[model samples]
Target: MSETADSLIEVLREQCLIQGQNGIKGLSVVFRAMDIDYSKRIVYEELKIALEKFGLLMSENYLRTLFNALDLNDSGGIDFCEFMHKLRPSLKQCRIDVINEAFEKLDVNKDEAIMIDDLQVIYSTNAKQHPKFISGEWTEEQVLRNFLDSIDTPGNPDGKVTREEFMNYYAGVSVTVDDDSYFDLMMRACYGLPIRGS
Candidate 1:
């Protein structure tokens, strides 16, 4: 069998082992239906069509972005191995870790705090181009104000967000895995799924 076929069979076997017979059966049906060419690999176009057929309408750019993320090997397609791996539940926690890492990078001074100046620079330089901030939905001023409000403490008159405060706010807004709401949003962005209100 070809590598693609072997990959498909292996993924199915693993899913069955992890998700049990019914789980694997359902996934098998979906994969078989999606493998329209019987090549055992899901090309970009096929995945796009399948998503659309499944009523998961997504922008072309978003679709391309999502495809790139899932195509770990840059092989120009997604095999069952890639699909199942990306769909793992632990991805939610992984996303949370990524957010925390980004926060640390933004903290800069190693002071365990994020100052308004730090936020200001990020807002001025990158907020405009950021997917969540673009479209004029959130002005830089609004973001700064919100950040300060969320992190400011009565004793900290200097208006800095402590690392703990920053992490708390970040988790509340973007990282909480409960209900997987934030994770779903991230996944949508990754796959080019439409974000509500944006």
Candidate 2:
């Protein structure tokens, strides 16, 4: 293997040890599955199939963007190292992107802020229906209170959540969750899978 490839494999081995066997085994399975032609690298079409298997169901344009981001050497395909790296920190960012997209959707009035009424409507209408992972283990009231505390400062007591505040709250929560479970949640989010218990 090339030095880069060797380095990438080492990283994957280390991550597997840290994340435990199941996590590493899942990644290995996905990687092998994506290497549909057994070429030891994943091409764009193969990647699309793999993501679909994970329930990502992303648009072609979005997939292209993601593929390009991970194809670091401009190699037209992603090797194991690139794939592992992408699945690591980049997957976390993908989860954040998912959160940001949902937040934008919840900003019903396009006012760049989510009002209490907007939140209430969302919670009432879709919270139970979707049961998003971000809701965590909190009751609706607890989730609402936590969100309010994050955004409603002394100066801004009007019960409105700005995009920044919303993102910050989630980013903070991601770090605070139990390490193993947090990564599991992030992995599920990355794959567009519904998290258990929401």
**Candidate with the greatest lDDT versus the true structure:** 2
Tens digit of per-residue lDDT, candidate 2, span 1-198? 345544544454455445443344355467676675667688898878866664446667666766776688989998765665444332265556656776776676789888765666655443444354245665555555445554442222456777754554444344435565565567456434566677
TM per model?
0.33, 0.35
Residues 104-144 of candidate 1 have per-residue lDDT tens digits of: 65576667777767767654555455555777778776666
lDDT of prediction 1? 0.56
* lDDT of each candidate versus the true structure: 0.56, 0.58
> What residue pairs clash in candidate 2, if any at all?
none
Give the worst 10-residue stretch by lDDT in candidate 2: 149-158
Candidate 1, after superposition: displacement of residue 43 in Å?
Answer: 0.8
**Which numbered prediction scores highest in TM-score against the true structure?**
2
TM-score of 2: 0.35
Which lDDT value does model 2 have at 186? 70
